[model samples]
Target: MRILVVEDNLTLASGIERLLKQSGYAVDCVHDGLSAEAVVSTEAFDVVILDLNLPELDGLSVLRSIRDRKLDSAVLILTAKDAPADRIRGLDLGADDYLTKPFDVGELEARVRALIRRKSGARSPLVSFGALTFDLNARTLTSEQGIVDVPARELSVLELLFSRSGKVVHKHVIIESLSAFDDDLTPNAVEQYVSRLRRKLIPYDVTINTARGIGYYLSKASA
Candidate 1:
C-alpha cells in the first residue's frame, strides 16, 4: 500500500517513513500542509498520516480538501492534540481514524493495517489472482504448492503491480513508489524486477505484460 505522511516534524516524519518501509509499505512524505495538499491531490495513496498543526494549511483544511475531492484514500489524523473536541472535529471532517502523539509503533501499524483492510473490504492482507495469492502483510507470494519466497525487491515490484491489476501502471510510478528519500532505483532496475517476477509467476498463469514505451501491467493468462 502507498502512504503519504503529512507531518511537519522532520525527525518524526523520517522515523515514520523508515518504519513503514521496513514493514513493506511504500511511503512518501511532506513536512508541511501545503505540500501535503498538493501531493494528496496528485498521487494515489492508500492512506494519509495527517498532522493537525501545519504551515501554509493546517491538517484540518488538508483533510477537508481530501474529502472534498472525494478521494478514496483513508485519512488517519496524527497530532499532539488529544482533546475530545479535536478528535470529534477531525472525524466530522471525514477522517477515517485518529491517532494521538507519543503512540506505540505496534498500535500505529495495527491501525494502518485496519484502515487498509477497511478500504479493501478484506479481513486480511491476501490478494488473489487465479491460483496465486499475495499476502501484503507477510510480503509473501504463494499458491497450492505452499509458500513462495520472492526476492525482496521483486516483491516490491509485484506489490505495486498486483494492486493495479487491470490498469496500465507507468514505470515511473513503480519507481517512485518503491524508492526512499535517498534510495536509487532506476527504471532499468524496475524492469529487471518485473522480468524476474514475470518468470517466477509464469507457472501460475500470472503474466506481467509490458506496454512498449509506456510501462507494465498484470494479467492472467488463459488456460
Candidate 2:
C-alpha cells in the first residue's frame, strides 16, 4: 500500500517511514500541513498517517479539507495527543483510527490493515476475487497455483482492479492510488506497473486488459 506520513518531527517521521517501508509499503513523508494538503490534492494514497500538531495547516484542517474534497482514502491520526477528547475530536473530524506517539509498530500495522480491509468491504484481512485470495495483513497472495509474495503497491493495484472487476479503470485512477502528491512519476509509470503486474498474474488466469485509448480492466481468463 502507498501511505502519506505527515509529521514534522524528523526522527519520528523517519522511524515511521522506515518501519512502513520495511513492512513493504510505499511511503512519502512531508513535514508540514500545506505540503500534506498539496500532496493529497494531487497524488493518491491508500492511507494518510497524519500528526495532529503541524506547521502551516494543522491536522484538523487537513482532515477537514480531505473530507470536504470527498477523498475516500483512510486517515489515521498519529500524534502526541492521547487525551480522550483529542481522540474523539480526531474521529469526529474523519480519522479512521488513532495512534498516539510512543506506539508499537505492530499495532500501527494492524490498524492500517484493518482500515484497508474495511475500505475493501472485507470483514477480515483476507479478500477473495474469483479463485485468488489476498491476505492484506500477511501480505500474501494465494491461488490454485500456490502462494506468491506481492509487493504492497502491486497488491494495492490488484485489489483496486479486483474490486472493480470487469470494468475499465481509468489510468489516472490507478496512478493516483499508487502515488503520493510529491512523487515525480510520469504518466507512463502506471502503464509500466500494469505491464509488470500482468506478467506476474499470467499463471493465475487473471488478465489485465487495456482499452486502446481508455484504461485497463481486470477479468478472469476465458475458458
Candidate 3:
C-alpha cells in the first residue's frame, strides 16, 4: 500500500518512512504540511499519517482541505497530543483513526491494516483474482498449482492491479504505487517490474497489457 507520512520531526518522519518501507509499503514523508498538501493534491495514496502540528499549514487545515476537495483516502492522525478533545477534533475533521506519540508500532500497523481493509471493502485478509489468491495478512500468493512466493514490490504491484481489475491503470499510477514518494526510482523501472510480473502470470492466464501510449491493464483470459 502507498502511504503519506506528514510529520515535522525529522527523526520521527525518517523512522516512520523506514518502518513502513520495511513493512512493504510505498511511503512518502514530508516535514511540513505545505509539502504534504502538495503531494496529496497531485498523487493518490492509500492512507495519510498526518501530524497536527505542522509548518506552513497545520494538520487540521490539511485535513479540512482534503475533505473540502472530497479526497477519499483514509487519514490516520499521528501527533503528540493525547487529550480526548484533540482526538475528537481530529475525528470530526474526517480522520479515520488517531494515534498518539510513544505509541506501539505493532498497534499502529494493526490500525493501518484495519483502515485499509475497511476502505477496500474486504471482509477477509485474503485478496483473490481468478485462480490466484493473495493473503494480505501473510503477504503470500497461492494458486491451484502451488504457493508462489512473491517479492515485496511484486506483491504490491499485484495488489494494486487486482484491486482495480479490468481497468486501465496509468503507468505513472503503477510507478507511484510501487515506489516510495521520495525514492529516485525512474518511471522506466516501473515498466521493468511490470514486465517481470507479466512473465510470472503466464501460467495463470492472467495478462498485464500495455496500451502503447496509454498505460497498463490487467485481465484474465477466458478459459
Candidate 4:
C-alpha cells in the first residue's frame, strides 16, 4: 500500500516514514501543507497521514480540497490538537480517523491497518483467496504448509493483486503503488516481481493472470 505523511516536524515525519516503509508500505513525506496538497492532487495514495497544524495551508484545507475532488484516499488526522472540537471538525471535514500526539507507534500502525481494511471493505485482517490466506496485519501469506516464503517486493505485489482479486489492476497502478516518490520502480521490475509471485503461489493453487497490454489479476489455478 502507498501512504503519504504530511507533518511539519522533520524528526517525527522521518521516523514515521521509516517505520511505515519497514512495514512494507510505500511512503512519501512532505513537510508543508502546500507540498502535501500538490502531491495528493497529482498522486494516488491508499492512506494519507495528515497533521492539522501545518505550514502554508492547514490540514483541514487540504482535506477539504481532497473531498472537493471526490478523491477516495483515506485520511487520518495526526496532530497534537486534542480538543473535542478539533476532532469533530476534522471528522466533519472528511478525515477518516484521528490520532493525537503522544501516541504509540503500534496504535498508529493499527489505525492505519483499520483504515485500509475499511477502505477495502475487508471484514477482517486475514484475507483469503483460493487455498491461501494473507494476514494483512502480519504482512504474511500462508497455506496449509505454513507461511510462504516471499520476498518483500513480491509480497507487496501479491497484496495489490489480492486487494482487487478479480479486477484488472493497471500495470501503471502497480508501479505507482509499489513505489514512493523517490523510488525508481520500473515496469520491468514489476514484471519480475509478479513473475516471482506466480511461481511462489503455484503450490497454493493461486494464479496471477495478466491482461494483454494491461495489468494483472488474481484467480484460482485452472483445473
User: Using TM-score as the measure, which candidate wins?
Assistant: 4
- Candidate 4 vs. true structure, TM-score: 0.96
Model 2, span 139-223: residue lDDT tens: 7789977787676667767766765556787777777666554566566777777888888887777778888777888777654
Task: Give candidate 1's error at residue 26 in angstroms.
Answer: 3.0
Candidate 4 residues 181-205, lDDT tens each? 8899999999888888888878788
User: What are the Cα lDDT values of the candidates?
Assistant: 0.85, 0.82, 0.83, 0.90
- TM-scores of the candidates in the order shown: 0.78, 0.83, 0.84, 0.96
- In model 2, pairs of residues that clash are none
- TM-score between candidate 2 and the true structure: 0.83
User: Candidate 1: global Cα-lDDT?
Assistant: 0.85
Q: Is candidate 1 or candidate 4 better by lDDT?
A: 4
Model 3 spans with C-alpha error above 4 angstroms: 144-146, 184-188, 209-214
The true-structure Cα RMSD of candidate 2 reads: 2.7
Give the range of the ten consecutive residues with the poorest summed lDDT in model 4. 157-166
Per-residue CA lDDT of candidate 1, range 89-193, in tens?
Answer: 999999999999999988998898888767756666888887788776666888999988887778877776665657787888777667654568798898888
lDDT of 4 at 20: 97
Model 2 residue 136 CA deviation in Å: 2.0
Q: Report RMSD (Å) for each prediction in the order shown.
A: 3.2, 2.7, 2.6, 1.1
lDDT of 3 at 217: 73
- Model 3 alpha-carbon miss at residue 204, Å: 3.3
